[model samples]
Target: MEADPRWIETPDDGELADRLRQGGEAVRAELKKVIIGQDDVVEQVLTSLFAGGNSLIVGVPGLAKTLLIQTLSEVLDLSFNRIQFTPDLMPSDITGTDIIQEDPDTGQRKLVFMKGPLFANIVLADEINRTPPKTQSALLEAMEEKQVTIQGRTYGLSAPFFVLATQNPIELEGTYPLPEAQLDRFMFQINIDYLPEDEELEVIQRTTTVAGEPPQAILSAEAIAGFQHLVRKVPISESVARYAVQLARRTRPGRDDAPDYVRQYVGYGASVRAAQYLVLGGKARALLRGEVNVSFDDVRSLCAPVFRHRILTNFHAESERVTTDDLVKQLLDDVKPPKSGM
Candidate 1:
């Protein structure tokens, strides 16, 4: 992967961090022109993108989840594609399919592969939960390997490929629940809450008025890809990395360091991927703040989005109206970071 021609190493940490911070501010300013106010949601999405990871956005309808993704696609100068996942959707519909085609003059037939919407740089898997497990499984390979295989033939996707999926939280009657394994593939499960009163009024006022022009592109596809690689190079202290791992470990019910609430409420804890994403996300967050070194605060701020969907809460907690977010906050309170040094 490092040898890929599209990959770029950061020449200067301070200069790159400053550029990233400036770019982030510009992106946010442009996003505000379209989106009313989901600052945290937008930031998390950008963080995951810079970290070269996928995101699963869960929210109620009419919250502009789709619009947010579309706007992001426009601002990043990425090839955009939106797949409306339905019950009857097939795997071939997403990953493309091979079809027979005849030569124009020779009358000889050969198979031709037609690319699907998933081939784009930014793919919006809208209402992803509406599709069955079989169709949903199609994204697993592309999301993990950045490639798809059909009939034992493989095709590489575009650079900086990202899958930003949305799910309706309130309506689950006809929707198929995403498998735990598939859910874990996402780096962050961002919960988009309703807008505040003032923001909602701004939304209404803006919609009622004439539509403004879309935001201009902030970064080219190659630049975005380069930034993704650069984000990985951000320095992280051993103590901060250890703090991330310790936080993930305490979520397990069987671990000796597990908190009392975790054993009582959690049926299963997060996987090692949780720890990995925590550090990666912290690195990205640090970059957007013009800092090259990830701090413990960066990891702590991302815990809810990184671990909320990964950790499984038991029926006892469900009956008690306890949420995974609450459990994660409790875990944060229970686990303290290394005080002085590594």
Candidate 2:
């Protein structure tokens, strides 16, 4: 990862923290114009954006996953591209390809590289699981290296590139599941569900009328980048860091730190990336709550998304209807709280 030049001279800690909170509030206000009551999903997206990480949104169809990303692009004033991943999709379709073209003046043939939709500032990978692993790997390089290499040449993506991939969980047939490697690249796997009764009613009322209002743009791409830099400056206590690590390590089966329930059910634990995301995501969560310091609550709340995809359950666990979410909750409950003096 390239060093952020904005960090050369750190701004006043207090003032910069306040700016991050204000920016987050502005983003939320803009998204509310179209999105109804998915505050948790919205928060996770905002947190990932500020933490400079990608998100995988899994939900049933028609839950506004695409709309949520579109609204985010408008709010942040970033170039948004949506790619509909299908079974027949190819890697070149997303990473672009070299095409032979005739020069207008000389009438000479030259290979021109046409950029794909992945070059945009914000990418909505719609139905990502519909595509095979080969096509999915195209995004892996971009997500991890923040660059694309084609034909023995590398093209750096725009600064602050974010991929918000959506996958349908209800369908299994004719779908290619994402590999663990690709899945681990995502900072958070957010589960978006249907709206509540009142929220659904509100959505009905709003969409029923033809006069549905469009959201106005709030922050520019540069401004969003600035806010992301600010998130990195949030201070995390030593205890929080250790807690984050322990939380990740304890998910493994038969570990000393693992709860009895976790040891019996979990087949594998989260990777170190989960611990890193826990700290960074907790900091972002704190910033969202208008705090300069990370708190245990931030880490606790982030456990579900951070561990859901990382943990693998055993067949016996699955037979018992045990979910990774349940294991994460149990781990959080089992971990002792920080000392009162600290």
Local lDDT at 226 for model 1: 72
Candidate 1, run of 10 with poorest lDDT = 1-10
Clashes of each: 0, 0
**lDDT (tens digit, per residue) of candidate 1 on 1-342:** 011232233577666667778778888888989998899999999999999999999998999999999998888778999999999999999999999999999999999999998899999999999999988888988999999889999999999899999999889799999999999999999999989999999999999989997787787777777788788888899999999999999999999878899999999999999999999999999998888789999999999999999999999999999999999988898888888953
**In model 2, where is the ten-residue run with the lowest total lDDT?**
1-10
State the lDDT of candidate 2 residue by residue for 38-76, as single tens digits. 999999999999899999999999999999999888877
Residue 329 Cα positional deviation in candidate 1, in Å, after optimal superposition: 1.0
List candidate 1 segments past 4 Å from native. 1-13
